[model samples]
Target: VRLSVPTGFGHMVMSGWLIEFKRQYPDIALDLLFDNRVDDLLRDEVDVAVRVMSEPPQQMVATELAQVRYVTCASESYSREHPM
Candidate 1:
């Protein structure tokens, strides 16, 4: 399988999964690519891409593997200056 993943979460999150997947599917070959930039799915650069986004692109089919929640934080001074 050709897999494209982002740099930030690639090694941190997907490494474990890739290990297990390889163990289970030892016969299948994998090509892994890491980049922060969004790849063109229509061009078939990668068969699958692991991305963190509010929504996936319109052109491709997606399956939600997990949901990520982001917390916004700031210093006391910055928070005080920009009050919600």
Candidate 2:
């Protein structure tokens, strides 16, 4: 499978899912690509992708893997100086 994932993808999948996947399907070859941009399906650049998009693209079929949350953090001094 040609898997296209984000450049900064979490290690959770790599550490577990991918390990098990390879173990279960040792014969199936895998091409792992890391990039932020999504490739066109017509081009056949990748068969599967994992992206952290705010909204799904109109042209592609997407499934909700998980809901993402945002957090802001600052140093103690900086936070005190710049109160929200």
Candidate 3:
């Protein structure tokens, strides 16, 4: 199977998953493409792609795997001064 994943996520998360998957399914061949550029799914450049976006393309089938949450924090001095 050919998989296209972003650089950071592919390196930190998918690499480990791929290792375990390879261990379990030794017969299946896996090709990984780690790139920041957006790939053309309709053109069949990749069988599957891991993308981070607010919305998926209307023409393609998509599944929501996970959601990213962001946290904002301020230092004590800044918090005291800005009183939010």
Best by lDDT: 1
Q: Which number leads on TM-score?
A: 2
What TM-score does model 1 achieve against the real structure? Answer: 0.75
lDDT of 3 by residue, 14-46 (tens): 788889999999999988888766657647568
Query: Which pairs of residues collide in candidate 2?
Result: none
Off by over 4 Å in 3: 71-84
lDDT agreement of model 2 with the native? 0.77
TM-score of each: 0.75, 0.80, 0.73
lDDT per residue for candidate 2 within 1-84, as digits (tens), equals 898777765354444677788999999998887767875755857888888998878998899777777789899999899996
lDDT, each prediction: 0.84, 0.77, 0.82
RMSD of every prediction: 2.7, 2.1, 3.0
Q: Deviation in angstroms for 44 in model 1? A: 5.4
- How far residue 2's Cα lies from its native spot in candidate 2, in Å, is 0.5
* TM value for model 3: 0.73
lDDT minimum window of 10 residues, candidate 1: 36-45
